[model samples]
Target: MPKHSRHSAKKRRDPRRKTMDQITAENDSMTLKRSLTATQLLLMGVGTTVGAGVYVMTGTAAAEYAGPAVLLSFLIAAASCLFTAFCYGELASTFPVAGSSYSYAYIAMGERTAWNISWLMLLEYGISCTAVAAGLSGYLNSLLGIFHIHLPQWLTHTSLQPVPGSEGTALTAGWRLDLIGFLSVILVTALLARGVEESARFNSLIVALKIGVLFLFLIIGVGYITPANWVPFIPPAQANFHFGVAGIFRAASIIFFAYGGFEAVSTASSEARNPTRDIPIGIIGSLLICTVIYVAVAAVLLGIVPYAKLDVADPLAVATQIMGKPWLALLVNGGATIGLASVLLGLMYGQSRILLTTGRDGLIPSVFSEIHPRYRTPARGTFIMGGIIALMTATLPIDIISDLVSLGTALAFAMVCFTVIWQRNYAPETKRPFRVPLGGIRIRGFWIGVTPLLGIIFCLVMILPLLFNMVHALLGGNPVPVLLLVGYFLIGVLTYRFYGFHNSLMAPSRPHEQGTSSHPE
Candidate 1:
């Protein structure tokens, strides 16, 4: 490392003094483990990425939007995800850092963009965890019901929905506080805080269980499909295309959540045996595996039940009930409960790492950068993130949380794509294990990275409807998910301007210059 001036050295070394440099260097103690193979990493990605969305959302989408055309919605969403994954594959290969998109943004775009990306990640990680927690509660209830144990509504329901297909307009809800959801979050947090290696291993096991359960669903559900259910593949259009289009776009955003944990693969780049090769493979390969699974599961789902009747919170279980195989519902629910645990663990792990990075950058409090010496993990950040996620799940509505997650995730991906382009122009000499091919010399005689540019455009297009819907909802209009993102981004700006900017590493000088903070090891 280059020798710093006396002032810079003091700032870099003193943990108590609270400069960004000190925090950054403190993280130098984190050693690489290289335990995960490409297969395990891919399985980790798939475990988190293929959760409640495919199992439940298929029915939800079929009921509201294209009916039989819900499969098309899955296709549209998959196309959008594929574009983003290419960008992720390239960046993960290059950075190989624990902070995922935030670290990439820092090196490529500068500190401000890094701050913003980290800020958005707070929501992406938190809300996604809470949403899965909610799903877990549903599955838990279903599992219990199989044993003839029906809990009171106050324990299971968040809000009431009108009785399905009933003209009576009567409404019912399960319960007020979901105990199973709350407990699952706490359990996953405990497992994650233990260590990265343990968490990855646990996630891998969960992924395997999910795959097995899905295969079971495919075999059993196939036998239950009636030829009559296939009559009108596309439900005949009603007079209102407004809800049709709106619902399709909304479902698209919802499904977007199913695609996000691939970035979590990048967050573990530092620990990969060969990050340059494994990170890209993990990101892209995981996405491909999950995408195929998602589409197949959605198809098999619609095949088992008429599309119109499929839109329950737990669609797969509902279908099993219709098949008069109550035991299968319990088994599927058990699988779903386990499946969502991996999602929460993966997402929370990714989010906390981002916060740890930002804290080290002096964009947040220095406390967040503190790693446990023995574990070499950011224990403080992990626990804090767990608390936030738990509180969020205990309070927020699942729909709002789901939408916010999609928006934040998309925003982070967009910045990463932009960062890739910016880095080629400004940091061409920087060493990278992977590089996006330059298509041409600079427009103004400067070299440009076209891959990131294309990635940005694709993400932007996919995010448009999400944005519109979110705004519409916020203004009491036809709201969609992207609006929640805008709201959170605004908060991020305020937070950065007031706190992160003032304390930022890019600032001209440090307040204390007397000592160096020791690295964690």
Candidate 2:
């Protein structure tokens, strides 16, 4: 290497050049205003958390497994979430950082763990944005169809296959690609680029609108509910593949995606005024509120129509259309369009922060850690993430994308629970504001391991049913589909090995405290 080139490399590697904390300093930087009260944060969580998953996935889950026993599926999912939420609450209260579990893992487990968590989160947030963007486009097209406005064909068609039963027959189908979905993704990226407060306020308004529409649905739709629809609540599955307990567990796995945005609350922790108190309130409060709404919506949906008649492949607009009220369908579609925008923004914010954290730790390129000179946000990383999602939404089929989102999130949650258990065993000194009580603290060594023991078991049990179903769904249908998913994880592993592993910030820090902010220490 030339002398100047060597000097440049030395400069790039200089630890004193700037720290992540320095990059995040309030001076001459756009500080994220600590304007979100617990109420706003809760609303933000709801805004991001409740979207296509409940409005669309409920029917699909009901059709595939659990039948009307789908209600139990949700309960099962929420219970698992409550346990994970306990884990998240403990971590968020202690660190109160932007990267959520990825950050928490970094501080507790070391660089390698942090890199994997961030890699998994990248899948969870970015690809999920693509899925949500596609969802928003579907709703928008339904709304526009009422006005006799149609989207162009070029935008709608992409290199993806429609789910087997979902492809309308050869004669009537106009086009396969979705242009509006791509546009919606771009629009959301634009909104995110503008700023966080704007995004939050926009989300708050949409949350109010969607919740109101849902309540109206409950009031009006619930009245039309007939007892006939509720019978055969646990219908038999095809091929004698009847999953009683297993079906509920599978439902729990799917519904888990519906509850994903609860972690978005933690992304704002660094900017929160009293992060320790507010972070937990934001997470727990949002879950409680959304869970109630989900149950109400499920009850009304199943009651109003037979589970067999529900369109698992179609979006929620069709469900309302079947209600024989086109205007209500319009309202539902509009609410969904607005509702999913908030989901995109919250998710985009999360993706950027994780990228920023990864860069700060030298796991990728340091440029990713760069905060916008004026916006004080991870502007570069945000743009890169949003652009990739926009392209994905423009091209990919919805369920294909959704599966990746669900798979990634499930893996991440499973790991998070494991990390919490690992912490209790190895790092007895770490501060935890809220701890899951395992009574008889001084009993035999086995007693000390019980809380973590149960937590790990809980995660594994929750994961098993879905793993079986997805594998079956993949094999029973096409092995190609399963290979594609494998491809995604393989890419993640390769990326980590060549880029993330060599560049990781963990080499200098103790594994147990790898990702903590150097400033705090």
Best by TM-score: 2
lDDT of prediction 1 = 0.71
Model 2 lDDT at residue 273 = 74
TM-score of each: 0.84, 0.85
The residue-by-residue lDDT of candidate 2 on 464-503, one tens digit each, is 6556656776656645446666887798789878876666
Model 2: residues with Cα > 4 Å off, grouped in runs:
1-33, 162-177, 237-243, 313-319, 437-455, 473-477, 508-521
Sliding window of 10 residues with minimal summed lDDT for model 2: 166-175
lDDT of each: 0.71, 0.70
Model 1 lDDT at residue 214: 86
Residue 458's lDDT within candidate 1 is 55
